[model samples]
Target: MPDLNWQKSSFSQQASSCLYLAAAPDGTVKLRESDNPDVILTTAPATLGALIRGIKAGEFDHIRTA
Candidate 1:
């Protein structure tokens, strides 16, 4: 894939690894982390939205560490 205009996540902390996202020219969504930009993950917008919603609903809370 060519270069994308990645935007940092608003919830990112100044001292923590940040999340970044961008929209590809083909309409698919691109995601990466500030700590590891070389590894990019692509997915459909709807799938990403669903993941966000699931996150908001505590669907993955079981995986949280103390």
Candidate 2:
């Protein structure tokens, strides 16, 4: 994958491990974290939108790990 015009969230601090998103030419969404830039995750726009909606609805709030 070539260098993309990744954009960080406005709520993120200047030097924090922020989430970055970019739209690929192929219409897919690219996601990566500032702490681990090499590991990129690609997904469809609709699926990403659903995930965001779920997040906003607090659907994943109950998730916990031991």
Q: The CA-based lDDT of model 2 is what? A: 0.91
Query: Model 2 segments beyond 4 Å from truth?
Result: 63-66
Question: Model 1, range 1-66, lDDT digits (tens) per residue?
Answer: 788898886777762588889999999999887878899999999999999999999998886568
Q: What is the C-alpha lDDT of each candidate?
A: 0.88, 0.91
Error of 2 at 14 (Å): 3.9
Model 2 TM-score relative to the real fold: 0.87
For every candidate in turn, the CA RMSD to the true structure comes to: 3.1, 1.8
Query: What TM-score would each prediction reach against the true structure?
Result: 0.81, 0.87
Candidate 2 lDDT tens digits, 1-66 = 677899998899864589999999899999998888888999999999999999999999896789
> Which portions of model 1 show Cα errors greater than 4 Å?
63-66
Candidate 1 C-alpha error for residue 17, in Å: 0.5
Residue pairs whose backbone atoms clash in candidate 2: none
